[model samples]
Target: MSIINQMLKDIDKRDKPQFGANRPKSVYLGRPLRTRRLRLILWGGVFALLAFLALSWLHERLSAPASDARPSAEQLQIQRVPVLISEPTQDAASQRADAETADASTRAEGEPEETRPRTTRGEQATVVVTDLEPTQTRAEQPVEPVEVAVSEQVQVPAQTSMPVVTPADTTVTASDDPGEMSIQRSGNGVGSADRLFQRGMDALSAGHNRNAVQRFREALLVNPDHIGSIEQLAAIQFSRGFAGEALQLLRDALERNPGASDLLLLKARIYERIDEPRAALDLLRGRQFRLPQDADLLILQGAAATELEEYTLAIASYRQLVSWRSDQGNWWLALGFSLERSGDPLNMQEAAEAYRRALQDRSLSESARNFALDRREALGY
Candidate 1:
């Protein structure tokens, strides 16, 4: 009985937990009987650290572009249009001031007056006009009349003592080449001038005179440096028989760029159209004028001289015109007329020779050819 009790006690001792032992007593051979929980904890920590690093890398990759300073290639191509704003003139200023002051009166009377844009006679708002069927988008926004920037440039004094001399009644014309008047679009598309200018040209081509004028004016408003818009606007005004307005715009352009020979020639032609031949001649003879061997200038000179009865000057100008455009029948016709009008016996013989040259041009219109023949008969050629 004692031996049985001793064997049970030994089994109980072997099953007890070793609380303070250096190694667990539950070991089988050289290894633990159960898996180590410490190993699992270490593996979990390693996996967690790897996941954190991967997530941080992804976050950085996504946010890099937003932190960059420079604009992207796509952003640089976006068109930036200008919003047009008008300054009230002196009379408009007085009216607005009066209206603002009358707020007290309105408060006392229990009535209010609506504010409105005021335009002087013949001046229209600077805006892009569409077809006869008005666009709802455009109609919703009120068009405000703006003072042209180019005109203001003309009024500015060049020096403190010497006031800028701008011809108040100036006018200009254009060259035959359509390309000479076209403004090229910019690479970066920074300004709205190109779009507005193109719209104006399209409107002009479509026979929408009002729309063309407004678009051109708006284009100039967007970029005051757009000389093409100013010239195009002036051309529309001239075609509509508003010669004075055309002249005013041209003078403003010339004042802004005094060195532009195209503007000078245009101004001379406008003077000729207005029947002021003397003015045309004087403009070409200005001190600031470059000595241009341009065909248009020579033709203008000859025509103006002929009109003024300056036969000697007319002869010289016509001779130069013939030198450049020998095929121009009108030039030969003018030369003959100038020589005949001189009334010199030597010029009379020269007039007969000039008439013979005019009759040789195949491109000359029938009316012009008949005129040449009549002139030749009159000159006893």
Candidate 2:
């Protein structure tokens, strides 16, 4: 009991209400200050964590380059990289080199490389081509150059050769070649008669009537009965307007040879030349009796009739001549002209037929055929 009493007494003293309330208030104030300090420490630790995370993000963004950070599709493409290894054996390398050289030589042979002018950034490359051969340049290039010759050609005079004449062996005296008879004999043997006749004929041909007549007379004196000389002389006299003299000589000649158609033609020519066409016609008609089928004589008669303006009779004569010598275009032309002048349609038809025949003749000249054709057209045949 005593121990219990003592403990109670101690407890009662310690367990007082006011003492208890005071002790609790002091403890609360001290605990409140410590609690606030702990809260501030916790908040500071959270802010430090957030600041460290932000600084780490800023460092990561500033450290990376823009191009390395974002790669494009082209940059993403994978490339095959070659790794250099050891070279091949010597024999294999030599064979490969030979094949490459052969290929290069073959390409060079097929298509030769052409040289072209090259230019750099600021300068141009100059190229010059020179011909290999001198003669080749002459053949390939088109250039005209003045030519110089080492020597010039010189002309020499030609040498001429002439014939040499010698003196004749024969010498004749005047008595040896005598008068007209001797002159005629000598002229005949040496063609002197032919030469004299040719001179006279030439004078007549040149229309020198007086000279022709004189030459013919001289020839006749050398030989009195020279027929050609006499006829020529008569023709010259007739041409000189001496028809009477021509007729006298022609008549005398005709008496010697009545059948001479040439003398008759000559006499008719003389008669016509004197404007006596009727007498010429009579003479031509008388000769026709002697020479019936003479085409030339008939042509002469046609010409004489034409001169007399007897166109019908002239056409008849020309027709007769054409019938005898069908190849003669002049006869046809004459007949056509005369018939056209006659104004007889029947005669005109006959004349056209004659010209047609002449045109068909191959032996006629082109001019003659054309003339006959022109006459036929003029006659309206």
Off-target runs (Cα >4 Å) in candidate 2 are: 1-225, 239-241, 289-294, 309-312, 337-349, 358-381
Across residues 248-304, which tens digit of lDDT does each residue of candidate 1 receive? 888888888876667677778888888888999988753332234466777777788
**Against the true structure, candidate 1 has what lDDT?**
0.65
Give lDDT tens digits, candidate 2, residues 277-353. 79888887644432344666677788888977888778778767766677776677777778778876667677788
Candidate 2 TM-score, true structure as reference: 0.37
| CA lDDT, every model vs. true structure | 0.65, 0.62
Runs of candidate 1 with Cα error greater than 4 angstroms are: 1-191, 286-293, 365-381
Q: How many residue pairs clash in each candidate?
A: 4, 0
For each candidate in turn, the TM-score is 0.44, 0.37
Residue pairs clashing in model 1 are 170-247, 171-247, 172-266, 173-266
